[model samples]
Target: MATNLFQRFKTDISGIELPEKFTFPFYYEPHILSKIAAQELQNYLQSQTDFEHNFGLEENQKGLIIGKMFGVLVCQNKEGELGYLWAFSGKLANVNHLPYFVPTIFDMLHEDGFFRKEEEILNSINRQIEFLENSDELRTKEIQLQATKIEAATDIQNQKNKIKRLKIERDEKRNSFTNLSLSENGTSNCELVKQTLEHELSEESKRESILLKKMTKYWNFQIMNAQKEVDLFLDKINSLKEERRQKSGTLQQKLFAEYSFLNLYGERKSIGEIFDNNPPAGAGECAAPKLLHYAFNHQFKPIAMAEFWWGQSPKSEIRKHKQFYPACKSKCEPILLSHMLKGLDMYANPFQENPAEGKEIEIVYEDEILLVVNKPAEFLSVPGKIITDSVYQRVKKLYPNATGPLIVHRLDMSTSGLLLIAKNEEAYKQLQSQFIRRTIKKRYVALLDGIINKNEGVIELPLRVDLDDRPRQLVCYEHGKFAQTRWEVIAVENNKTRVHFYPITGRTHQLRVHASHELGLHTPIIGDDLYGTKSNRLHLHAECLTFMHPISKEEITIQKAAEF
Candidate 1:
């Protein structure tokens, strides 16, 4: 079965040379062989009837649509024949087994497996919880308990009011009898009348106190009974939920243990061990890990590999059809780097190299209170994880006496723009306040990859960072912050649209995402490596800025033209 998984190339590859090293799974340009294999697999997906899955490519396709990530690994067999293997992330068509793709590391969906058996039990517990939560008995008991509480409170208050009125009447009688006794005509009779009135009042007060206690006791009993009935249903629901939680934890641990991968040296490590016993969901199920695991076990020498998105993009993340992407950092990085790719020569990580090397920052404007500089592309506003040379560091070194944080605002490392700097804490606060108040004006020039039909419009798409892949953003309406950009077409030449962007909100990757997202312009900025294809440099530059000077109290404007 594993032998047939290696697919021979369908196209002539005599002119192409194999790569010297395996691909750096985190980032790289797809090798020619990998690209050829991906095209062949895409062709098969378009015409084959081997399986059914809704990728949401059609105008009216039904069912739960999900676009998938597909990968191809170029390899050489023992016979020295060059070929490639295909794999998809997760299960396809509700099953892990398919015709030509690599199989999963573990078959959790096997009918006779422990996972399925435990899943059934978990499902049963879920059903019981749902039934109890939605039962008529539970609903009726809850409603009854609430109504009884309200009725008891009202009745108890009425009894208290009645006792208060009775006490007031007794006091009045005592007052009237004392006045009669003060008169000389009936002194003896008044004394006897006073004694009798006192006794009667005492008896009345005692009776009223006893009646109030009785009323309170009765309402307490009623409320207690109603609450007990409601708790009966809730107790069962809670118990079942606890059982489900424990079972789920146990099952997940067992499943993780079964998904062990083998490296080139035949060293085996489970997903739990790789991720320190806390792997994210679908950790070992990605296309890269599956392909590499199969290749190592079957003795296929890996040469290069690439993964690409297919079909419509997901609502949250931006994934253009047929666009190559890096393997996810959160899920695949730990597994591949720590266990699977051991002893394999691979490309060096580009992120480790400082991109700001040999670039100089040009001073655009300078004054006693503040200044502005023309930041070069691939230069960080502040220090990064591996590299410490940045615009802020340079400015701080130039002005050692400068107070507060020198950098007032930032530009993306890939963006060449005007960065503002403050010389003192007061100036920094004044300039930063202008940004927060939306009083500072900024305009950027960009070259889009595709032509824009509309001349001008506003884009209001919320954005948040993709937790699975840091530095990459997602269009998440639920958890994202508001991001807006207004753009106007400046010119169109060579199938590219040059435009000016006025941002209303400053979010991470605001303009890049708004340019490429389907809901926005649907045209990525040229050389936007995160959102679009990589190029020589990102063609986005901050061309203009307007704000009031802190010391001079006069409005100031600075302009810089983009080199591209």
Candidate 2:
């Protein structure tokens, strides 16, 4: 009967067949609920070209823009009837508009209360900051004076060099006198010439020193006074900024305290309690979560959820218009995870099980210090939260006497590759040091979803976790760690490209992000579950590894070519 509830709902959109259920956390296809919601959003956004599908990108730029995500919450109200609620990434455009979307978490447009008065002051402060920043006369003067000082310093140096050249010529003339024939009383001709030159050089040196002092004093006085004025303005700007920050923090805490959330298990907590570990910034503020939160609180039964992007793509991210993206992991995962109703069917991950449990592991190389084995695809290199069966446990069962961390470096569960295991503490420490010191070389062979034009290049994109969505990474310039990847195209087959990846820094999902990100390779790896579409398995393999032997100190390189 529960399954039939979802089956009963079908749209008149002729050729488009939505999936029976929604996407899971790790794997999924879209449901009809999402499609219907997307259609509505598309129709609405088309009327307002200014509305953004992207939630956060509100800056000016040039390029073809893609859309951001908007979601729908399908639920049964108190009458046991099904209807859907709509929401956007950050906020909505014109809540009063027709087609009647769900209300945002907080009534930001409320004319009365603390939100209005305090927000007015905040806006005023922001204007002041903008005005001061745009005032560039003082800054321009500082630059101009700096140029003057550079020119002055250059002139002084050139003058001193000329004096040195004169001194060298004088020394040569004196030396020639020693080898010259003496005139009358063995005296050199033009003795007065040497005295004249010496006097001239002395005058020039004195002039150079005096000019240097005067110039230094002049520039220092001007520059220091200019800098002091600039500092004064900056101090005012910073003070106002601090005030705004404190006020914003207070407002958020107040709001969080006021709002409460409910879960399917009949458990409930105020937004503040749920965010006890970290202060809420953008969490639970998203449209889908907000809609769900409202339904569960009002005693509605939720059946399905779907979100779609409807605006131009942000310049920084690769978002396509009308493309359906799952609910973000950064902002919504924790809230939804604890809050989703229990009866709803959740998606499942295949890798959550030990696919290689009964399968054989091939030993590529072995010794007393360590063992190098070819890790099979779908086999986790180490134990995970759900899957306890892994290469570590397998090796531990075989060699109970082994010491230290067995896994030197880990491979993703979906990837098959060469894994190095240390037999003892010394070997483990030694092998880890090689990785830390970057002496170890690793190469990944992957098939990409698109053809790459460049033969070889280096990708330097900073990365940070998308706070709204868990496990999904975004190209973030701020609050991001440095990640670099070097790649060379190996070949192209079936309109697909293959490349060898050389990662310079080890960030989680670095290779995947760098490959798919528009700023990086702009090629999604074939079958990548997180950054790209789902497939039988991720088309990535840690095909080669090179490191030093702990005891023998010999350089060892192992290769396991990808089967695909």
Candidate 3:
């Protein structure tokens, strides 16, 4: 008789002895096929590190006394994702005898619940489509609104232009009329002609009066019409601006909602503080260092916090006084906080009484158009109104006849190196054009953490500032602007590598970010706050710059030794 395929898969082992009698149909299966499937699943898991696990078979069964089972078959996969099999009492069947049963059973079970999976996938796709459509609609509406505002602004500007043109035309007409050799110390030229004609004098005088009245009326009409158009245009501008603000507000709400939904599971952050809470740092022009210190400490009075951080006050003086300690006789908490914070000069420094007189800075090169200088670290490249000892100030003093010495480029405050200066506006504009066109070349030397693999190669990576963390950057593949740099290893010591960098783009903190994050070298220039590994000093130096001279039309190259 042909046995049931599933019956061969089962074995009975209630004890050391097989069961004497069986009540249920004993249909057991080995996990040989399931183990094979698990192996494939392991390969799939290997592709995704965040979703990881181990999969292996761990079981052995002994058989069967004369048509009776003594051992059992067992298999298990972690996570309880798969746990379905049968146990029975009988002679143990070899896996070869029942190949079709396990596959058929697993397939049947999978099909039983497959529709739910398909429905879930379809739902996810629908949600994404809906979100995309909404976003497009909002964007289109915003663009249309902006276009309307721009049209209104343009109309107002055109009206003003028309008014100016009308004024000019009227003035010219009036000047020509008054200077027509008709209104002078002598009688009017028309009057003199009329006098000679005698009988025609009365007729000519009447015609002249009529002509003057007509000209005056025409000029007044034109002026009034131009002024009316100007007023109408200004009114339209104001109305359109109000409409733009409303549309902008709508767009902001939609965008903020979308952002919140997508980032629900991400790090939580807030744009504005709660009513009574103060932001750790305020936004825009009122970034008070003292208030920021207070917020960082997280100790706040509701009224004081609201006023200082949000530029708002409590409803009444009583609430203000109760919640926040009053400042003498004033009811405003922000005013009190600002005064209290400003009074503490913990971070402020006093002017030196008889400070050391700065030495005259060295001028590497100078001419009629430009000057090149070896700038010392910690010295300002260009002088501020308050600065007395900057390289730019010194150069201006040395060439007293020169005017408006412009800084063409600059090195960082902690970086000491060579720089070029334009002496006049023409040279400044020429040099600026060269920089904008990427015709100038800048190179630097840096000591890195470890020796890079290639003795000499290139690192093609993009960089941008991390505005949130203040003076840091991350690998932003999606939104970052493009930046490129070429690096070559100069020398390899026991562990550290000396590398030379030539930046094709002059982005802020480009070289430091590329070396540390892209190359995984973690190399930073000495004294740099964002990229340096230690606080002692950074290990980078601006060693060279090469460009064409704006006036002399000669190739110029400036070089400096690494500062340490």
Candidate 4:
């Protein structure tokens, strides 16, 4: 009776809910199960030893339906839920296989009970489909409403834009009439105003142009007049200078009354006492007047004329004066005193002796190691035949016993003061090293062409000799050795500046080149010629030298004043 009922229920359920390909139960646990676990069970049956070759598991709301052999096994389980998993094995499409249970669990449920439960699952799934269809219809209506609202808003904006455009057109037409009337009135007024402005501007420009022309002409005339006045001033100054020179010439003659060699050597009265009697009445006829006249006529000579002046002297006295004809060719003269005193105030003094030549020329400082002297501007530092009668010759003559007084360094011919000489070879070597190493310090005084802007400053530049000219140097950026100098302004007078220059390097003509070329100053050292105006003289003066003493092995500093 129970088997008949089970078969009857299966026939009824199969007929009522048969799918075209498959059928599934309506159960929450089966629909929500992980797809991975369902697939794992499907794969397991395909490879198992008791499983037949034709096998398949279809996932549905009942978790999975296992179809193998000739029967199906349906399972119900949630995630993390445990259930007895059954495998059905029988003749599927006329084939047979062994039936098994997972984890060794078995179930003995009839198809009558399973069919009854499956019917309820199908009914529940039908209700969910109906609800989803109704919700989709409502969502479609909401989307259509939103689209309609957007289109209506866009049409309203277009209408507003059209109205604004029409209003603007109407306003433009209305303003055209009013604007035309105003433009007519404004045009008439503006034309009149424009004509009046143009007339005013033309008249003002004409007046300004005329005034500018007159001012330009006036300025030009003033410039020419000023130039003429300057020329006249310079002419007057030159004239006055020449007039002064003439008067000075006559005055010099009267002061330095001519010395007669005949009178000087033959007479018992000294040249000083003879001048005390009988003063000359005229400027040209003083007792010393002939001395100036003789100097004006004679060439440069160191000694007096032997036949006229020194012929009467005793042989011993002549020898004492170094007066041998061939050996002592240097000439002495009375005029030499006047020539020597040319720039001194004592030229006009009546009572002056011929400067002594016999006295040993003084060495300002001398030791076994070093010798320092006040070198005269016109004297050479080293002895040679030409200017051999120099400071060096005088030094050697004074210190005849000393060995090899080498000239460690030298000042220029026209540069004066503080010449250093080495007494021995070792001192010479040491001093030369100091010079080469740039350890010795030197200071000079210069009279510049114009007042410099700064009171004190330094000039650091590279220097190189001029390739075109032998004795000149140029500022070379590409290839040159470094040189530096420090300068301080001493005083300013009539735009002429007195400066003290300290050279850090012993470059030839470094300071003069910097002052004139690099500085664009045209500042010539009072008498410098190469970096100065053509009429200038070399006006550099060595005023100081400081270094370690060669022999004393102590610090030595020397200073002197420039000869004006």
Candidate 5:
């Protein structure tokens, strides 16, 4: 079959027009055909022995399945006949398996190919790295030795304390003899006691100093040498990993260059050009795109499509068994967007069009140096990359001469309520200072999606944006900023818990991440699309803002109630 084809008004093979609705490749509501396929797949999985039993039973079981993603793509033939194609993420599980699905766009597993050789070489490197890791047990033994040395040093100190006590008692006895030395015999006894005490004290001081020196000097060379060996081993492993990445990246680019992608319009784009930044690791390897590409090239009308996860979820992210997921942003977004059956109910691009249309910025309080307003949901607090209608623009219109950034603190676009705007440079500096010093107190009222066991607690999780996916943050200890939120449940409403949030240190998505992270509240805020499921609106609102007035130095408090 021809691998790639560009769009046309009508295929020479069929006179049918393309489907009217453009399918947004990434996020979509599954079609009826997809639902049926998913149900069948789920039924098949249930018959398998341990499909759902132990997957999420423990925290450690995540990402252990080595699972594969599967998809069912619906297609119509040139004669207007409809059928579905089944495909897997990378390759069929077994090489000898009977063919039940559409063949992959290209056999990624051709034994005589360059790809196979590169993969084999990469495997060899991985094996060496693993062997090195297993053989290096010196670090564990070094820790044990470190503890043993500390205990031995402690024992010597205890002995030194005992000797000091004994010396003190002898000195007291010698003093008593001195007071009673009127007789010659008493004087002789006093002299004997003093000599004994002086000899014992000198011996104890000498032993203590010698023991202390031994503690410092003993095993010093061996331990240092052992630590150096462990560090060198780790460094070698890191160096190999970098080399492996470079090798894999080169292979990825080569494969991407050879492959071409197809869209619903029947347009063609080379995978290499689709990903100008870097070709994703597994390009044209996904099930849905593979099926669609084959069908389109074979002159079949590509219809609806769906992909479902087949195994345990990763620890950091949540995924349900049999639940469908959108194409991955880092790996599959560009590919899918370039090659899905298009013209099927496309998603709107809020960035290109005005996202804040028909919205009004409500000013709560206005003064010569400040503006306080209720920021509407979906409205940016300041000018954003794509959406420019913001509270900053509104305030700028109201006070054209106002200097400094008028928008002080920003609320997430999905969040609604109180916002403070500084009108002048001096006022902005003073207010910003209060925020840096944490003198500014702000409260957010949120409704959690699930019941929260604790009534009140504090969450301190380091957070960083998932660079692989934009606008989403995760709890990453290695590279994250400190974020803290104190929460107290206010009320429970209709199987949901309403909570009060007092932020101590502000970071992007601070409250949202704290509420959803397992180490934190372990409950996502209601209607959090990024962390939780999508809903009508985000059930979070910045209800209050309190800070010392920049000029008056008086405490100011602002409050707004959340709507559901």
Candidate 6:
């Protein structure tokens, strides 16, 4: 029964009913059994002395702080006894085999494993490259090459200047000879003297040209020799780099092939096949897959599963401590949907359902040129992939003969806000220009999950989409758009703060991320499903909007209060 890996619950859970189907994995609230199991596992983590890991919870913790995602899978044995299995995503404390958590699907770090052998070779290649790159011989050659180029340039310029001076002197000599011949006036000796003078001048010009050519040739040879020496080292470095690249690719492919999973029907599929031979790094090593694989292999009837963050959030992504998060889409979707849970009865994906059903958009202001509508929370400003009922669709139906794109700006699906709409092409262009030029003013009111210490401040954070998890953003400095927000606290009550956000730059989920990210406010907005805990709704509303009238050239301002 593998009692060591699977443990019985400490508290009686007989009163709780089991989930009707397996967890959808991508999104779903944890079942009672799964929650209980997670709580129990967290307790063990607090008291366990099996390993040392700094989760950055202490004020002065040392070492590289790495937060982890831990998961629990509830299962029942053939004897009808219910229990749960525990697993952590990836490795903990540089080790794959821990005391209570399930073992990794494939132990690549084992001393005798093929992965280790190949990794050693790869490391050796890296060391060789580094040594050559920093070698005194390479540095000396590079410096000599640069110095040779400078010397050659200076020598060539001097030779050119010398030739110019020589040509001027020759011109002066010809002029003097011509004047002497003219002064002789019809003397045969004078004609002979002029011819001799011309011949001498020609010879002098030829000598100067030859000298310049010889000097140039000498400098070119010196520069070429220096370049060749440098290239010799570079060629070796490039060859080794190519070899390392090929070996790394081959090693990754072999590792992918080694990572295979099993489903309920005894069907086995390799990670390569699951992701079409191009999986992201660490695809099959997440906690959900490991727990499910272990449960299936051990004849445990899978019930429900939940994954939670066990420590401090990472610098780029928003992951609160002890918060339950959905399975990452980029890595887990292909593995779980395509192969692992083929025959299991799973919960219906909530993302597929329309959040805007039975909701309506309220028109706040209407004129001949443009209009404003208060979009409800959970309503889409534009048509989404699965849901077609949106503000754009509704507005289009109302104004069939209207020209250009009906909506000028957009709000997120979960954010309730005032959206500006244009009825004509000219109006749309003018309104859009106002927004682009930063003339349009906007204010959003939100309820934060925690109180902010500062009363008023500004936040500047660069943002980019989390490629692995769609709709989720990361604070990335490398490839991100600039996003800024100014906020002032309105009131603090019941451990939550209400604040007004004035975004200077519009970006997807800018305010939410700026509020939740550790570098920003470090307090997520209440009911923020992506960055914080989910509630009945995301407590953010676009309360005020001010822009110039597109046709009339008059300023217009509209305001609405949040329902939260």
Candidate 5 residue 488 Cα shift, in angstroms, is 1.4
lDDT of 4 at 207: 62
Q: Could you tell me how far off, in angstroms, the CA of residue 426 lies in candidate 2 after the best superposition? A: 2.5
Show where candidate 3 strays beyond 4 Å. 1-360, 382-394, 518-520
lDDT of model 1 at position 217: 94
* lDDT tens digits, residue span 500-556, model 1: 999999999899999999999999998887788878999999999999998788999
For model 6 the local lDDT of residue 303 reads: 96
C-alpha lDDT score of every prediction, in listed order = 0.92, 0.71, 0.45, 0.47, 0.72, 0.91
Worst 10 residues of 6 by lDDT: 177-186
Count: clashes, candidate 5: 9
Q: In angstroms, give how far residue 23 of model 6 lies from its true place.
A: 1.0
Q: Candidate 4 on 412-531: residue-level lDDT in tens? A: 654566788877777888998998998899998877877788898888767787553334566776776788889888899888888888888867677777666634334666655344
Candidate 1 matches the true fold with a TM-score of 0.91
- Deviation in Å, model 5, residue 297 alpha carbon: 3.6
In Å, residue 248's CA in model 2 sits off its true spot by 7.8
RMSD, each candidate, Å?
2.8, 11.2, 25.8, 58.1, 11.8, 3.5
- TM-scores, all models, native as reference: 0.91, 0.66, 0.39, 0.34, 0.67, 0.87
Instruction: Determine which window of 10 residues in candidate 4 has minimal summed lDDT.
Output: 300-309
> Tens-digit lDDT track for model 6 on 1-564?
377888889979978999999999988889999999999999998888899899887668788999999999999876778999999998998899898888888999999999999999999999999999999999999999999999889988997898899889989988887887678777888777778888988898888889889988998999899999999999999999999999999998898788899889877899988888888988888999999898878888899999999988898999989999989999988989998888999988877888888888899999988899999999989998888889999999999989999899999988998999999999999999999999999999999998899999999999999998998999999999999999999999999999999999999999999999999999999889899998989999999999999767888899988999
C-alpha lDDT of residue 511 in model 2: 91
* Residue 46 in candidate 5, Cα distance off native in Å: 2.8
Better of 1 and 3 by lDDT: 1
Query: Which runs of model 6 end up more than 4 angstroms from their true locations?
Result: 1-3, 77-80, 137-166, 207-232, 273-278, 437-445, 450-462, 475-505, 514-523, 543-548, 551-563
